[model samples]
Structures are given as C-alpha cells and as structure tokens.
Target: MADPKGFMRHARREWPRRPVGERVKDWDEVYVPGGVLPFVEQQAERCMDCGVPFCHEACPLGNLVPEWNDLVSRADWHAAAERLHATNNFPEFTGRLCPAPCEAGCVLAINQPAVTIKNVEAAVADRVWADGLAPPRPPERLSGKSVGVVGSGPAGLAAAQQLTRAGHTVVVYERDDRPGGLLRYGIPAFKMEKAQLERRLAQLRAEGTRFRTSTAVGRDIGAARLRARHDAVVLAVGATAWRELPVPGRALAGVVQAMEYLPPANRVCEGDLDVSPLSAAGKHVVIVGGGDTGADCLGTAVREGAASVTQVDIRVLPPAERDEAVDPWPVYPTVHRVSPAHEEAGELRFAQDPDADARLFAASALRFSGDGAGRVRAVHLGGVDARRRPVPGAERTLRADLVLLALGFEGPEVAAGGAVAELGVAVTRDGTVARDEEYATDVPGVYAAGDAGRGQSLVVWAIAEGRAVAAAVDRHLMGATSLPSPVTASTRPLRA
Candidate 1:
C-alpha cells in the first residue's frame, strides 16, 4: 500500500492543461509543459493497493500499477520506469492515447475518483528519458534466427524490440516512407508530438532492430521471398480499412474519410507538407462518430482554423457518473467526460452558445448535400429512438463545407491482407486474421498480432499482442522462451 490514509489525504488531480485559447493556436501537446511531475507523487499515493488489484487485471499489458504507484510515491523514478517497462514496451504512447481502463478498475473508483495512474505513467516515462536511462541493450549473442515484421506500429515495434533483445535479428517492414504506421500519421500532432515517438525509435535502432521503410512485403517484394529470407514472419498490420457512410452524395469532394483528413495534417507537422492537403481552414467542419477518432478530427479542425466544428454521435450521451448497477466496480463505465479536444472545442463555441456542446447525441446521418460542383455543402441528420430507429420530425441540416466520417475502421482489407494469403493464413468472418490462443496461424512458421488478428483495439492491446507473439515466436525457434506473456490472444474486456 502506498499510504494507508493517502486516498483520503489527497484528492485525485491530473496534469494541468494549457489555456484553450493558447493551445488551439499551435500543434503542440495540449497539456502544459512540466506540469505533471510536481503532483505526480501526490496522485500516485492515492492508490489503495487493493488485495485483488483490479487495475492490473484491467490492463491488457498487466502493468505493475500498485508497485509503480508505491515507487512513485516513494520518489523512485528509475524503479517506477523499470517496473512500467517490465510489462509495457511503450508507456509514453499509452500514457497519452490509452483510455485508461485501469483507472476505471481502480479500487478507489468504487467510492471516490480513481488515482492518476496514466499521468504518473507519463511522468515516469519522461523521467527516465530525462535521466538518460533509455540506452540500447544489444543482445549478448546471436540466436541465428531472423524475423520480418510487416508493420511498424506499436505491435510491430514491440515484437521487433523484444525479438532483437532476445538475440534474434528483427527487421520491421513498413509501406509508408516513415517507420511508424498510424502513430506517424493518423493521430493529430496536438495529441502527441512526434519527438516522443522518434526518441523511442532511436532506442530501438540502437538496440539493432532494423527498420525497412517504404518497403511493402506483398507489393514491393514477394511475401514468399521475405519468408525465405527470414525464419518467421509476424503480421502486425493494423486495421486500416476505413469505413464509409453509405448514403447519397457519397462522392462529394469535401467529404472525406477521417484517415484522409488526419494524415495530411500530420504530414504537415512532420515537415513533409507546408500545408495540409485537406486543410479545414475557414470551413464549417462536421465530424461524424463520437469516438477518439472524431475527437481527433475536431481538434485538428479547430487547429486548422475551421469556422465551426460539430460532432455527431449515433449513441446518446453517456451517464454523467458511473452507474454501479449496470457497470460494477472493476468494469469500465460509460460516463460523460470531456477530452482535451472537447474542452478546447467547448471553449471555442462557448461565446456563441453557452449550452451548445457541439455534439448531437443519438443523431443519425441521412445523407450529405453537395453543391452543384459536387462539393459537400451540408449534412442532413435525424435523431434516433432507443432502438436506433428514426424519431419523427427530428430531421435537421448543419452547414458542412468539410465533412469527416470518423466512423471506426472495418478491419484489414484483402489488399492489405496480401501478406496473409502469401503466408497461407485464414481470416475470420469479421474481417480479422484468424489465430489460435497462441497467436499461431494454421500455417507453420507464421503468426499474426495487433489489429490484424484482434480487429480494432487499443494501442496497449496491440503492444500486448506484439509481446505475446514475440514470446510465441521465440519459443517456436528456441524451444523455450523467457519472455512474459501478459495476456493470451483470447483475452477480452471485462465488460463489452
């Protein structure tokens, strides 16, 4: 236990965010610089260290939450980072992007606010980086076996790193010019700066994890050739087939997929583009879908100087507070919480309409209206009843010069699954690659991980899948593995 009375002594508080007016003007991270460290110890002390420690169970990586909380409270930054890395390969990524289901399962959440585990995690990661503790650990001897990973996202990165350290030669293949798959493109810069990602990549490179960028295993080179060059292959390709709104005016010029809109903006941040090709400047932007992707689009639109930003959610607003009856302790709850982007958007719109949340709950899109030149002009939407049926007389039109469909991905595409066929693996009916509990495909010497096998999932889960697959591959080659397998491929959320 951190402190017997620490939960009551200190209230749960998170890192401070920069002023909305100041932050929206730039693409830097939304939080204030060096803000989390001062109070990180205080927040870490709030952990009760329950007998069961549900937070660890909730996390896919099985992070040492209680141990690190105690370490942070005791002012041991190096030990905290060591414990965090014991399970997770990239705490920095999860700290910024993950929804923190571990916090939802916190023992304190039963009666009080959850501990600031995510913030503490970020602080510990940053502390280690600042302390120059991220030196590369090259393998003592070569294992002779080699692996070719087909993605450079979190999962692929994790597998590559683990295999490299386990004395195997690992090469990560990425189709994009840069190594990081979605992390380098899909996410907006305001959420997480690329410097954090670059530094980690530097560590991986120092550790001898080779990255082959702009190389498509299935298209540029044959997958069979790659298999022959390497002992095994691990598919960590993410679920990137963006879903569409199949309605009238589907081909409007201004209406684009969320991937199309976000990647260009990120490219501009990467210095590849002077201006984003899909700039939202001076346009009325409407983002459909209330998930993190929609929030990302909203934030990017706001930074790009959109005139107005509106978000549409198919489901109604979640409860203001956790409902113990429906979602008990240790299960992630449905609660209305304002993300950093939402806060900035709310501030942007507060002057015009104090009550406007810029979100239309339970709203279903009917179709998009296009101008004579085939550019999106407006979006027609209607409210839905409890059963998701259209409500009578609830139709409304919103001005939308730029419409970004943030509806989540539809798993991997067959074209993207080109490597799967070359390796002779089976895909599930739900559009994901089929693998058994060991992440092993029907074909020998080939396996799958991340969204390719698990469908759309969190970054933490992808890393976990990567680690598990690395273990499976290591054992397959060395006849035994010393790596820790945190979760099996069949693991599911406590509550759907």
Candidate 2:
C-alpha cells in the first residue's frame, strides 16, 4: 500500500461527470476529460490488502485486484496494467460499463466506502494505452490448425485473441457491417467512445486475428460448411432477443424495442447515418423498465432532444442508501443507483410495489390511442395493484409521442428470420444455445459462449467465459494448452 493511513486521510472521490446540460448536446462520454487520474492513485491506496480479499471472489475474471491496487498505489502504472491484462482481455470496456461488484466486496466496505477499484482499473488501462505499453502478443509458432469464431462481441473477440496467440489460425464472423457486436453497435458512444473499441480491434488485427464482417452462419455460409472448412468453430453470439411487453397496444407504430432504438443512435455517432430512424427528437418519451438499458434510453433521448423523458419501473423505489440486512457488506447491493444517464435526466418514476411475482406494481399500459395522421399521440395507464389489477378510479392518459420498450431481453431470439434461426444452431428450452463443459454444442467442433450459453449478463462475465472457452478449444485443437480460465460455471458470488 502507498500509505497505511491513506484510507483514513482521504475520502473516496469518484470520477467527475460532465455537466448534464453540456453532455446532453453531444453523444460523447459523460466524464470530463483528465479529471479521473488525480484521485485514482489515492483511491488505489485505500486498498487494505485484506487477508481474504473478497473483491477477487466477487469478480468473474478473478482479476488480481490487490496486486494491481498496490501497483497503482505505488504509481507503477505499467505493472498495474500487466496485472490487469493477465485476466481481463478488455479492461477499457469493463472499466467504463461494468457495475463494479468487486468494490461491493471490498473489505473496506464493511463500514466505510470501498476502494475505487473500477476507477483505478480504468486509469491503469488508459495510462498503459497512453504510454504505448499495450502490445499484441503474436504467437511464437503457428500451429497450422484453424478455428472459426462466430460473433464479434466480447466473448467471440476474447476467444479469438487467445486462440490466435496460442498459434492457431483464427477467423471471426460478424453479421453486422462492423465488428464489436454490442460494443460497436448495441451500446451508445456516450458510455464508451468507439475509438477505444477501434484501437483494440487494431491490436487484434496486428496479432493476426482475421475478421469477416457482414457474414452470418447458416445464411451466408452453411454451419456445416463452416465447420468443415475450419478445424473448430466457436459461437460467441450474444443474446439479442429483447424481453417484450406482450400487453395490448405493443403493436403501436411509435412503440419500439430498446435494441431497435439503440443501434441507430450508435450509427449516428459513427457518421454512417444522417438521422436515426428511431430518433426521439421533439417527442415526449416514456421509457419502460428501469435497468441499465432503460437508463441508456433515457440518456439517448436527452441527447436526441426529447421534449421530456420519464423512466418508469414497476418495483418500489430502491432505498437511497443500502440496507445492510438485505444486502450485507462484500456483496453487490440492491440499492438505488444514479447512473450517468440518471444524472442527465432528472426524472425516475417508481410505480407502487406489486404483491405478485409477475404482477406489475404501479405499472399500467392500458392502451395506445393514435390520431388519424397515423402517429402515436397518447397512452392510457391504469393504476395497478399488487396483482396488476386496475384500480377502480386510477385510469389516466398521458401525452406520448414515443414509447421505448426499455424492458430487458428474455433470451436469444431464435424465431424464423431472426439472427439465431439464421445461424441454424440448436437452442435449449430456455432459448439459450446448448453447450457442454467445453462450450461445444451437440454439433461436433462447434462451440458457444457468452449470452448464447449463460443467457443475458454483464460484459465482464462474457469476457471471462470467452477466455475460459478459448482455453478449452485450444486444448482440443492441440494435444494440450496453457490459456487461463479465471472463472468456472460453478463459481457463484454472494450476489448473483
């Protein structure tokens, strides 16, 4: 540790966000430039180097948190970056987007605020990139074996990078025009600028990983043909299916799914599209569901110049502060969180609590009423009780030009004409692709990872799974392999 008394001397300071009004005018990252580093070293010093180090257990990648924290505290930026890269393939992505469950599991969090592990990790990554310390790890010998990776998301990229470095020829296939799946298209630029992704992709290309974009398995090429051409195949297709509201009026013209809305906004940021087809400009937008996706929609609406943005959640509002009994220390808490989007948009409406498990609390979408012009005008809501039954006198109409269904995804979409169906892969009853211990499906030499195997989850989990699955594929291709598997399917954290 840099200073034994550092935690006592300096209070926790987070990265400062840009002024809401200023950030709303553009789709750039929310944080002000150059403000994060000043406090990062001190924050790293706060690590107590606990004997148990619960923070490690909390991370899916099993990142050497204390070692890196010590490195950062000592201002050994290069060493810290190495330690971070030892496990995580994309620290920049996770540092910006992950919820930071490791901080929740920090020993310091038993009472006081936890060390800013996430911020420190990001700082180390940025510093390494600036210092030109991050380099591609080209393999010492080409194994002559070839591997085909489907999907260009975190999992697919991570697996491809690892396999390529292990001396296997690797090819990545992405249906989108560009690589980086959600990283490139599904996520907004404000959360993480595209340049960061592009830089990583450049490094991957340098390391001899080949990318084939605008290609879909079972469509552009038959899945069997892909397997025949390549020695092995890895499927990193993410869960693209959005959990939809089956309630009436979902068919309204102005109502759209979160995935449909987010991509065009990202395209606009890429300068590929002049205007997003689903632009929220000049509209009274109401986002359903209060998860990260919803918050993302809220921020996007604000940037799109929505007349007003309101985010609604059926659950009773989470407490401003964490409740110890419900969420003990060293475990991720179910407390109120204020994301960058939440800060930019000042309205978050919590519907009354519902009694039944599936019932909507304070949730009501009675119907959609549109004008003769064929555009949406208003929405009808009924005050719902615990059972989601409409209250006798709680019916009300709200002006709404746009309704974004920000509800989360259920599983990977496998319907006809959908991405999964086009892939021609076998899926489980729950809709996820079936995979064995090595992440290989029933089809020989074919593998699956990320949301396609584990369902919807954080990016960190996807990266970890990718690394693990890559190791399995490498061993299968060669007689043996040495890639690290930081997490297993059985490693459960205190908090799910």
Candidate 3:
C-alpha cells in the first residue's frame, strides 16, 4: 500500500464538482480538474483486501478491483490500468457514467464509507491515456472468419474489439451518422466529453475494426444477406423506442420525447447544429420523470437558459439517508441523490402516492391547455385516490411552456415488415427481443446483446453483455473459444 495508515490519516475525498453557475455556462464535464489523483491513491489504501472480495461479484464484468486498488496504492499506475483493462474493454466510459455498484459491495462499506473505487478507476484510465499506454492489439493469426455487429453502442463496440483481436474480421454497422450510438448523441457532453469516445474509436480503427456509420442493417441491407456474409452476427442495437406519456395534449407541438430533445443538444456540442430543435431556452420547462435521463434534461435546460425547470416523479420521494432495513450495507441504497443537475437550477416535485397499485394510481394529466398557435401553455393535473378515481378539489394547473416526456424507453424499434418480423423472432410480453443462453434468437446465427436483449439498464451491464455475447459468437465460429464471458443474461443484483 502507498501508506500503511493512509485511510486512518485521510478521509474519503472525491473529485469536487464545478460550481453550478460556472458549469451551466458551458458543456464541459461537471467535476473540478486535477484534484482527484492524490485523494484517489489515499482511497485505494482503504481496501482491506478481503479474503473473498464481494466487489468483484458486484460487478457484472468481474473487474479486478482489489488488485488494481493495491496497484494504485503502490503508485504503479500502468499496472493498475492493465489490471483494469484485463476484463473491461472500456474503463473510461464506465468510470465516468456507471453507477458504481462495485463500491456498494465493498467490504469496508459495512461501517465506513466505501472506498472510492469508481473515482480511482477513472483516475487509472485517465493516467493510461496520458501515458499513451492504450494501443491497438491486433491478432497475429487470422481465423478466416468474419463477424458483423449491428449497433455502435457500448455492447457492439466491445464485442467488435474483442472479436477483431481474436483474429476475426469485424464490421460494425451503426444507424446514426456517427459510430458511437447513445455515447455520441444521447449523452450530453457535460457528463462525458465526446473526445474520449473519439479517441477509443481511433484505437479500435487502428486495431482493424471497421465501422460502417449511417447504415441501418435491417433497412439498408437484407438480414438474410447479412447472415449469409458473416459467420456470426451480433445485434447490439440498444432500446431506442422511447416510452411516452399518453396523456391528453401530448400531441402538442411544444411536447417532445427526452431522446429527441437530447440528441440535438449533443449535436450542438459537436458543432454540427446551430440550434437544437427542442431547445429549452427561455421557456418554462417541466420534465415528467425523475430518472437519470430526466436529470440530464434538467441540466440541459438550465444550460440552455430555460426560464424555469421542474422535475416531477410519481413515486414517493426516496429517503434522504439510507434505510438499513430496506437497503442494507454492501448493496446500492435507494436513497436520495443530489446530481449535478439537481444542484443546478431546478425544482424537484414528489407527487402524492396512490394507496393502491392501480392503472393510473393518484396520477392523471387531466388536459393540456394550449395557446392560440397550438403551443402548450399549461398542464392540468387531476389528483386521484387508490382506484384512480378523481379526488375532490385536487385539480391543479401548472404553467408549462415546454413539456419533455422524460419517461425512459420501451425497446428497440422494429421496422415494419423487416427481418425481425420475417424471421419470426419472438418478443417478450414486455416487448423486449427474446433470446436464449447464447443470446441467439429463434433464427440461427443471429444474436442479440445489451438493451436489445435485456431492457433499459446501466452502461456497465451493456458492456458486460457485449463481452459475453462476443464469446458466444467466437465459440460458435471456431467450435471453441478463449474469450471471457464475465456475465450472464440472468445475472442481476441480489436485490434486483
């Protein structure tokens, strides 16, 4: 360890977030610069090197947490980075965006605050990048097999890199103009700058992974033809079909889906768009969801100069502190979290809960009042009781110049009369694509991964599924494989 008594001497110190007012003026990451390394090393010393590390179990990718922590504690940055990348293909992405379930499973968290594992992981990745340690590792021998990856999100990219390094020719197809799917457009630059993604893409390109951007596989190329060309096909198309609010006045011009609003804002960061179509500037914005995506919208609105921003959630507000009975130690707690966006200009409203789990609950968007030009002016809410029956004298109207439906996604969109339908691949009752252990659908040689296989989830899960599916494909192609499958489709948190 760097210091025997480092943990005793120093408290857990994390990267400081930028001042809300200062960060709102630009699209840079929210954290304060250059103050993370020294503290990260100190935090690494907090690891007790448990007899059986549960942090590894907590992570779907089975990351070498304690080994890297020890390496980092010893100031062996390069070794720490290597140990980190041994399992995870994209530590940079996960370090920035993942919720850090690994920290939740830390042994030290039984009493004290968990070691800052996520922050240290990010520090190691940043150090590796600075040292130019990450280089292309192209395979020496060609397997004479080819693989096709549909989607350019985390899952697709991870699988593509692994498959390519295994001596198989890989081609990744992305429907968007750019290669990084949600990473390129959906995520705002303030969370993770696009430059990090571009650098990884450069490395992947150098490693012989070809990218075909602006190509929709099922639409542009026949699925049958694609299957014929490649020995195996991995579908990593993320769940893009957004969940929507079907309340009255949803058809209003000023109302739009959160995904539709987020992309243009990200595009603006790329200097590709002069103005986003769903700009939140100078409007009274109301975001109707309190998830991470909704938080992202809130932050974007504040930066875009929205006159006011209000985020509403139907569920009862989470406890400000962890509830031991409900959420024990070494598990992620469902406690209130103050995100950078929450620190910015926004009002978070917790809706009154309905006693019963009925269809509408105590929720009802009564109507949408609009202006003369058919633009939304305000929203009418009718409070209901346990059975969704309207409560007496609970009608309220809130001024809403722009309403964003930040209500998450459903599943991947199925194009009408496309290969998905033609092949008769099954869909679950919830509309997610059905797959077996190998991530293969009913049709042979066609596999699914990430959100396409599972529903909406964390980026860490996506990367894990990608790595697993790649191993399955490699095994199918070569009769056997050496690639690692760190996670399974059934793997989830103990509570989840």
| Residue 45 C-alpha lDDT in model 1 | 90
lDDT by residue for model 1 (39-132), tens: 8998999888889999998999999999999999999888888899999988999999999999998988888899998999999888889998
| Model 3: ten consecutive residues of lowest lDDT | 350-359
- Candidate 3 TM-score, C-alpha based: 0.93
lDDT of 2 by residue, 340-455 (tens): 88766663221122211111337567677787876777767777665556678877666778888877776776777544565566888888988777777777777788888888
Model 3 clash tally, residue pairs: 0
Of candidates 2 and 1, the better by lDDT: 1
Reference-based lDDT, each prediction: 0.88, 0.82, 0.83
lDDT of 3: 0.83
lDDT of 3 by residue, 313-381 (tens): 555556777688988866788876777787765332211222111112244566788888999998777
Cand. 2 Cα-lDDT? 0.82
423: Cα error in model 2, Å:
6.2
lDDT, candidate 3, residue 290? Answer: 68
Error of 1 at 172 (Å): 0.2
